[model samples]
Target chain A: MTSPPAVRLTALTRRFGEVEAVRGLDLTVDRGEIVAFLGPNGAGKTTTLDCVLGLSQPTSGAVEVLGLPPREAVARGLVAAVMQTGGLLKDLTVGETVRYVGSLFGHADRSSAVLEEAGIADLAGRRVGLCSGGEQQRLRFAIALLSDPALLLLDEPTTGMDVEGRRAFWAAIRRDAARGRTILFATHYLEEADQHADRIVLISHGRVVADGTGAEVRALAGGRSVRATVPGLDETLLGRLRALPTVDRVEARGEQVHVHAGDSDLVARHLLTATDAHDVEITSRNLEDAFLSLTQEAR
Target chain B: MSTPTHPADAYDPAGRTPPRWGGFNRTLLGLELRRMLRNRRTIVFTILLPAGLFLSFGSTGQASDRVGSGNVAAYIMVSMGLYGAALTAAASGAMVAMERSLGWSRQLRLTPLHPAAYVVTKTLVALAIGAIAIVAVNVTGLLQGRPDMPAGTWVACAAVTLVSTLTFAALGVFAGYLVPGENVMQILGPGLALLSFLGGVFIPLDVGSTIWHIAVLTPMYGVAEVARAPLTHELPWYAVVNAVGWLLAFVAGAAWQMSRDTARV
Candidate 1:
């Protein structure tokens, strides 16, 4: 039989006072896959990550990392994480911090190697306090690599990085992923989710609204909301337009009829030639718009 | 070119090999102690400050003045040593609070360091610094204070002061987890001073006075009384009970706070 997924959460629920931070989250991360956990603010992304790392206990249900409990997996150095903020000692130099964490996993000399791998070799002597936000993140990444962890979790790891720094960070991550390590990164950056992730899991209101390949999720949030000035708008006309394979929804508003279509090109052509539609405008959906629509659709 | 050998391959993939399993993590403990020693504040509090207190109080006491069988000068030195050692040990342990606020402790929680191991290591390291303070004060007394005391009395007082560090270290760890920010030590400094005074370490309260009755109940009182017992040669049964009682309380508090802090993580 095949082993269980690298990470699993079954009906996981967590509450903070009156707020339900994570509600019945069921997720599985397989080995050797780069998955992006995407969500807007307070969408339970961090909460779920916290549970997977055993930093927070689930209020109900179960969570397992690498076929073991999160704590157990961590103890074996099978799981490692680079959190968004504040898990470092400001007093220690980058090399010292890396050395200290490496030692915790019984890998004393691995720190320098990992620092080089994470592209922070020049920052060895710089104290963590003196490092810039991006530099500190790189240090965190270096420390994460010291464990030779099988499953890596990056929670908004690129939050404070500049455009160039983010690119470099993802490059290092891709290099690691090429070696058959599992990676699950939480990000609000739609471009990163689209470009770097093999699969995208979109969350809204503490529940996953979409989970599929980047292209597939993009399709869920696909469809242009096109509006135009059309004379003699009626239910028969709306029904006819909706009947088109490219159009999912068509509605009449005053003198104008709005059409939501999978392929606006087909809808636009049909509208202009078959019906008296004017002032036709088509706007392509950016990833941001697609993300927002997907989240809103779930609500 | 040969492929690089991964570190995980050094251990069994199942991670049950005794050689690779993380028990107490000695490297982590070594780094923690190394950093603590390099910290200037610990140096001042555990070494320099206590010696200064010893020279100031221990050298000036009248040689003729006596408490029980020991000279008043030796008494003053012992008391100052207790005050310094306890404070330093407690402060050393509570330094974790500042690191916690900076998110270092939470970072540690993600590591393989066991909770029990964390507690034991912290307590021991705190005591180590406390030992430095106790030794510094006693050596000052030996060289500069009135030398009329017996060597046995000297050793006993030093022993008591050194052992009492465990109590303060546990208390420090409790304080570290209880308080939220960098101000834990700043607040604890004054708090410890007040407890020291109330426990009759700085000034002896009259034996029959109401303050003396209440002093014995204070946390510091037991530690002070037990440390001075070697000088007085009048080790009271109640004093041992009091010290044990407070130590138990501090230890329980430290462990409870530790578990509560990490239970969610």
Candidate 2:
């Protein structure tokens, strides 16, 4: 028999008293896929990741990792996680911390290799308290690599990193993923999800709003935004633009007007010829637009 | 669906070999011991307090009065040793509070290390700390030459005192899971002092008195009595019951709290 997917959640729900943190969430991640759980704050990204790590049980439903229960999978060294914060002891040096975690797996010698891969080998002697947030995140990354797990779960792993640090981190992660490791990370940054993930699963308020390739999810919004600079803008002109066929929404800011529509050509012609509008530009929707429209629609 | 009642029922569709309980980790124990040693306040409270108290009080009254096989000074020495061991063990066990606050416990839950293994490691650390405290207080008594006891009795008292501190270690673990990190020591410090009084470790109580009846019921009462048995030649059956009974209670409470601790809010 073949192995199951890397992770599977069926109708997973977690409630904290009156608040439902995760509600009826269902997702499946296959082997070697770099999947991103993209959502805004309080969208239940961390809650879902916690369930996958076996740190919390779902109030209802089931979770499976590597064709086994989450805890069982973790106990077999098949799954590891890099939490968002506070896993490092401030007093221990980076080297000691990595060595300690490695010893848990009986692989203390792998500490140096993982430290080198995480790009924190030179900071080995520095106390974790002294390390910068980005450096600490790298240290956490090093510890997560100690087990050489088949699946890696990262929850907002780059929240405190600079642009350069994020780039280096992703580069290292990409290299690791190339070795056939499955990675599922949760983050709110749309660009990070679009640029790195093979598949993006957009979640809002504990439910998935969209799930597909970056381009396909963008296409789900299915419209172009026509932007132009128009002088003497008034309510009548705004009304006319909103009344255009196939137009979804119209917005006016100073001398600029934005009209979202399925028919960009008609909106563009109406703006340039009918009104005194210049510098007209029409472009397909980006991931952020799709995220906003899709999440809003879910609401 | 109900939770799995047996380990065999855990999901294993791919038929991967199940991971066994790999005994306690030594590397973690070594690092934890090192961290405990580095904490100056723990050393001061666990070692110096009991040793200092013994030096001042053990020589105060009836210098040559003998009870059983030792003098009054020997009696006070045994009491002080038990006090220090209990304090040290409890403090060492309570280190879990800091580990929890740092999210280190949650981090460990993701690994192959078993939760029972972690608890055992912490208990071992407590025992180590307890041993240190017992040795420090006994050594101070030896160097002072104020306490008189046979070599065999001295070793026996120290061993019993060190071993009995396990009860307090479990107590510390229970309290660690019950309270926040910063508040653990603050609460347990005074709480232990009151227990010491009730146990008759600080002030001797008249036998068959009203307070004696109540003191025997406190958790530390059995520990104090059992540690001083070699000197007092007293090994009452109820003291053993009290010690073993409280140990089981605290262990159960700690296990319950720890299982809840992992259920993240």
- Cα miss at B139, model 2 (Å)? 2.2
Deviation from native of the Cα of residue A190 in model 1, angstroms: 1.5
**CAPRI tier for the interface of model 1:** acceptable
DockQ of each: 0.40, 0.32
Over B1-265, each residue of candidate 1 has an lDDT whose tens digit, in order, gives 1124532233233853211434466766787787778888878887787788667766663754878778887887888888888888888778766676677877877778766666677776776777778888878877774745788888888887989978888888789887867667887788988998898887777886999888888889898989989778776677788899999999899878867766645
> On a 0 to 100 scale, what is the lDDT of residue B97 in model 2?
64
Model 2 residue B43 lDDT?
Answer: 95
Clashing pairs in 2: none
Predicted candidate 2 versus true structure: per-residue lDDT over B191-263, tens digit per residue: 9989999988987878899999998889989988899999999878988898889989987987787767766
lDDT of all the models against the reference?
Answer: 0.81, 0.85
lDDT of 2 by residue, A1-299 (tens): 44577899999999999999899999999777899999889999999998998888899999999878898887777788998899888888999898777777754369899999999999999989999999999999999988777889999989899999899999988987876688999998899999999999999999998999999888777678999999999999999999999998999999899998989999999998899999999999999999998888877
Model 1 residue runs over 4 Å out of place are A222-239, A251-258, A263-269, A272-284, B1-23, B64-70
lDDT of 1 at A186: 96
Q: Tens digit of lDDT per residue, candidate 1, span A1-299?
A: 35457789999999988999888889988776899999998999999999998988899989998678888888878888999899998878898898887776654469779988888899998888999999999888888887778889999889889898899999988877777678999999898899999999999888988899877886678767778888997888888888888687777878788788898888889889988989998865666877898888867
